[model samples]
Target: MAQTAGVKPMAIAGRVALERERCLGMTDAERAWRKQWLKDQVLAANEPVHVEEYWKERINPIRRFYRKPLDVLFDKLTPMLGASRAADYRVITGKLGLIAVGVMAIHYYFKYHGNDWTKKGGWRVTRSKPMVLPGQPGFPYKSERSKDSDYADRGYSKSSLFDGK
Candidate 1:
């Protein structure tokens, strides 16, 4: 029912988050070991002889390429991600949910309020000035005295709609 549906999403999200943490927490040593193992497999396949013969022939060169780097990488990484407690997984998953909620809330808030901050032309008002009609004179009360000058030039008169009563 409803409970199961809700639990499903949480479980899926938690698993994904756990997997991400696991990968992120992998030590350089572990990664290097994995990479070298893969490389060894590839080189072995490319050998012209049986597996034993290939290992015997190419072992030295392959070891030279993969072993040293793998050891160095493993040594560096082991200290960082070598061990994780069961509680650590739970904490990481919780953090993942919190992050997801925080991000969604921010996105929602922006989407909801972003339009209110912008005008028809996408212009944002940072000041408390009143909007002026296009082709009209400036603040009517303040510019009243100068009306006969610019107003007359623009063919506007005291009877114009923009002329403040």
Candidate 2:
């Protein structure tokens, strides 16, 4: 990439904020103030900057987005739930929501796809072991008789799906 004369390389985030403020009707003075603020911030923080720390914390795009909506939602619910209760409720619900989604995804994977997955620790049997579906690599059950079956004459198909109960 070549830099043209008079062309400045602002970060993509700064460009987005610029467009957002323009769309939301920012005055020219406000825009000038923002530009000055950015220049001042760059001048103040340019020296002794830790590249590793900046990349670790400030590189996330989602955090930039989630902050606004979460703040808005917290403000809306605070009147009803109180400040402390609202914050606690947000944290609890966020964790529980992530957990529910994870459980549902794992259940779906195991039920539909019978295969082992390689992980950081070791190999894991993500699906049913010795898969019960027909044409699977191994038999689902050992050579023992099924608990639901006692009739020697009846084939395996004779037992109802819920006969164990």
Candidate 3:
């Protein structure tokens, strides 16, 4: 038998078609059952090997679908500025600027005005007094016996106990 040029492998095509068919043929009951099964599998096992395997199997396709476009964009942009300069530009302009803007915006919005949506949702603004340590001036420190004081009186330092020594 002569093979046609530009034709995909039969097994590969068949597998794709089978997958499509299986996806298409999934009834509501089957989907619900699978969802319940997945939930059960996730809940029953602290470390879900099967779910992890399923996710791992999905990774390549998900990566290919999502990362491929970003990779293409990167490849296209890289040469215009050269790789090193492009990478540096991306880090400084893209990552750093995003973080800086996010921090500044959050600081400005929260500091100047309280969150509008939260206020609209009937949230009341409450201020908590700064917790002052013992012997600290200005704010009055409570003399209540706390866990720290109890631990300190036992002749064991808080740092030492935290270090497991």
Candidate 4:
């Protein structure tokens, strides 16, 4: 399993050692009683954990907003793969998962960015006014706009069409 995941055995053993050490008042005899069993437990805990839990936590809740055609296949997979293979599957599926998450984030961003669903719809990246917190500077908005009018038209992103010299 470690080989499949590209994790060295020594690293796994090191983690197991750390786990064993974290147990307060654990005597050497008890600690060594079943090192292999303890190691296995720690190893399992360190992995992505059972696959069903991963799907429930990461995927299923978003079903209302986003449903994919392959979701049915993914949902039925645990019956064949079993929970033990879930961690490995998580590693294997990580790239595809990342792409899916990225796409979803982009979708949400474009969908909610302008508050288009609301009555007042304007394409604003952020509110122009700053929410004042106690002890912070007043209306201290972050901007790349130049303090000087001369430099304003000199910058790379010349969004403004003004030619004031």
Candidate 5:
């Protein structure tokens, strides 16, 4: 006999399918307990998820470190800032934290990954050594063009590549 107002057969089937993976390698007793725990966790619509005893025991102590200080801080601020202003400050603090994380991520990218897009080796000009043009003082007229020439070094040589060096 089917109960129209209670848990459906499909819900049980879905839960079994989901839990099947988790149930693998578990002892028979442990599997049974897990299934029972999951069934108990399933509740009617509009109810918040119930934290299990194990998780609550582990998290409570860690949560207290921030929870107590924040509670006291907000309580003290509520009179001076008012409830709305205090809530705004809380939202602003969260946004500032997100901005800080974004900045750090960008800094990490530029520091570690920026070289991939950048040109390599001797691309920048040195201001200390100004160029000496021909017909001006310190110009080199004795220089013969070769592989060591600026033109050849820049890959603009007119020589045919098929010709052996």
Candidate 6:
């Protein structure tokens, strides 16, 4: 490093202290100018790279390949469906969701209530086990000789459900 004309040689610690004092003493405008000058110097030292153009060049072929079929489909449907409705994602999503839900509901109804519509007795809904309420015989625990051994069959059935464990 070149020495200043009027500056005296000093230890590294003394130089650091001097720099800290000088930085603390600078005005807001001087600090801002100094920051900008340093940034400009850093920018000037590095070569510029066109990141957006580079990425676009790399991705253009893949995008074009995938988009052609979709574009053609859109073009064909635009006039028939009305351009606005054809392009509206919300409407398409809502209709698709409704159809999916209807299909699932029909499937579950057949699964739970048998698909035998021509039967004499008609469809019968499958029954689930009854829920045991608080203060009931099997409120949170089952007795050793309980008629239903659903819970008692398991070795650790004495655990209290109310205790959150």
lDDT of 1 at 98: 75
User: Residue 54 of model 4: what lDDT?
Assistant: 67
lDDT of 3 by residue, 1-165 (tens): 447576765542232235666566777766676567556545544453347567668678766675455456666899898988766765565566669989999777766665333244432355455788767785575444555545324223433444543
List TM-scores for all candidates, in order.
0.21, 0.34, 0.27, 0.22, 0.28, 0.23
Stretches of candidate 6 exceeding 4 Å from the true structure: 1-59, 89-133, 136-138, 141-165
Off by over 4 Å in 5: 1-72, 115-165
- Residue pairs clashing, model 4: none
Which is better, 2 or 4, measured by TM-score?
2
For residue 123, model 1's alpha carbon misses the true position, in angstroms, by 13
> Can you give the lDDT of residue 85 in candidate 3?
78
Those runs of model 3 whose alpha carbons end farther than 4 Å from true positions after fitting are 1-82, 111-119, 122-126, 138-165
lDDT of each: 0.53, 0.63, 0.58, 0.57, 0.62, 0.60
Compared with the true structure, the alpha-carbon lDDT of candidate 5 equals: 0.62
| Candidate with better lDDT, 2 vs 6 | 2
In candidate 2, stretches whose alpha carbon ends up further than 4 angstroms from where it belongs are 1-59, 66-70, 116-165
How good is model 2 by TM-score? 0.34
Per-residue lDDT of 128 in model 3 = 56
Residue 165 local lDDT, model 5: 43
Can you list the residue pairs that collide in candidate 6?
Answer: none
Model 4 over residues 142-164: C-alpha lDDT tens digits?
55555655342323234354355
RMSD of each: 21.6, 17.9, 22.8, 15.7, 18.2, 18.6
Q: Which candidate is the best by TM-score?
A: 2
Is candidate 4 or 5 superior in lDDT? 5
Instruction: State candidate 5's TM-score.
Output: 0.28
Candidate number achieving the greatest lDDT relative to the actual structure: 2
lDDT of 3 at 147: 54
